[model samples]
Target: MSILFGVVFFILGSLIVYVFQKKIFKGITEEDVVCEVVQKAFIRVKNSEHNEHKLVRELLKSDAFIKDLSLTAKFQGSIVGYILFTKIKVGEETLLALAPLAVLPKYQKKGIGKSLIEKGHKVAKNLGYKGVVLLGDPGYYKKFGYSSASKWGIKSPVKIADENFMAIELYPDSLIDIKGVVQYPKEFGI
Candidate 1:
C-alpha cells in the first residue's frame, strides 16, 4: 500500500515539474542542430508539412547534409522547431538549400521557426556557403531576405512556381552571372 502511494505521488510531482519547466522556458532560444533532436522533432512536426516523412529521413543520410549549419529550438530540452540545409549545385557553384523547416504544430507562430531560419543563415554564411535557397511562401520568406530565384536566373530542377522558389545571397554578387537549374542531391529524389 505504501509503495503504491509513493508511485502516485512521484507521477504527480513529475507532471507538475514538466508544466512548470515549460512555462518557464516557453520562448526557447536556438541551439546547435543535433541530429537526434532533428529526427525527433521531425516526427513531431512532419504531419503538418508537405514533404514526405521518408524524404526527410533520406535527407539525414545524404552526404550533402550540412549538419553543422542546421538549427533547432528547444523548450526545456524538447525540440520544438528545426531547420535543415543541404548542399545543392547550380551549375559549377555549390550552395545550400533550406528544406523541411518545421515547428511543432502547437509551437507555431511563437517565432521558433523564424529564429531557426535566422540562425541557420548566419551559420551557413560563416561556413562559407555562397547563398541559401528554398521553396516556400514568398510572403513569409521575403521577410527573411529571400527573393524570387528567377530574379537571379536560377531555376529549380523540377517545375515549381517562380514565387515559391526563392534565394538569398550570403555574399555580395554571389549569384552574379549564375544562371541554371538548381539541382539537389540524388538523395532528395526530386
Candidate 2:
C-alpha cells in the first residue's frame, strides 16, 4: 500500500509541474504563431462546412488577397488562441473580412480573442484597409466597434442573422455611401 501511494503521488506531481511549466514559459514565434493557433482552433471548432484547415491554406496562397493578419497566444511553446483576417472586395473598393476567430478550450475567457481582434484591426488600418466585416456574435464583436452591416447597405450573399453580420470602418469616411454585396473568397462557398 505504501509503495503504491508513493507511485501515484509521483505521477500526479509530475503532471502538475508539466502543466505549470507549459502555462508559464511558452511563447509563439512571430512567423508561425497564427497558423499554429488557427490549426488548434480548427480542431476545437470541428466545423464540417468550412474545413478550417483548408481555408487557412487557400488564404495563405491567394495572391489577390492582402496580408493575412492574425494573432496568437502561447504557453509552453503551444498556441492557445487565434484569429484570421483576409481581403474582401466590394466593387472597386478594398476591405477585409474576419473569420475563424478562435481560442483553445483551456485558454478561453482569458482575453486572447480580444487581443487578436484588436491587434489585427490596428494592423489592417496600417495596411490601408478601409473596413472589416464578419459574421459573429454581436455581443462580442460590438465591443470591438462592429455594427450591423445593414446600416451601411452591405449585405451577405447567403442568409445570416441580421444582427450577426457586422462591419467596422477603419477610416472615417471609408464605407460612407459605399454599399454593395460582400464578395468573400470562393472557398467560403457562398
List, in order, the clash count of every candidate structure: 0, 1
lDDT of 1 by residue, 1-190 (tens): 9999999999999999999999986765433234334544456543334444455567777888777865667899777777788899999989898986877767888898889998998898888988888988899999989999999999988888899999999989888778899989897777
Write down the TM-score for model 2: 0.74
Clashes of 1: 0
Candidate models: Cα lDDT each: 0.79, 0.79
The parts of candidate 2 lying over 4 Å away from their true place are 1-36, 39-50
lDDT of 2 by residue, 1-190 (tens): 9999999999999999999988875763343555555666656454344366567667766754455485556778867776678888777787888887878767888888888888898999998888999988899899989999988888888888889999999988789877989998886667
Model 2 worst lDDT window (10 residues): 41-50
**Model 2: pairs clashing at backbone N, Cα or C within 3 Å:** 26-76
Best by lDDT: 1
lDDT of 2 at 63: 52
lDDT of 1 at 113: 82
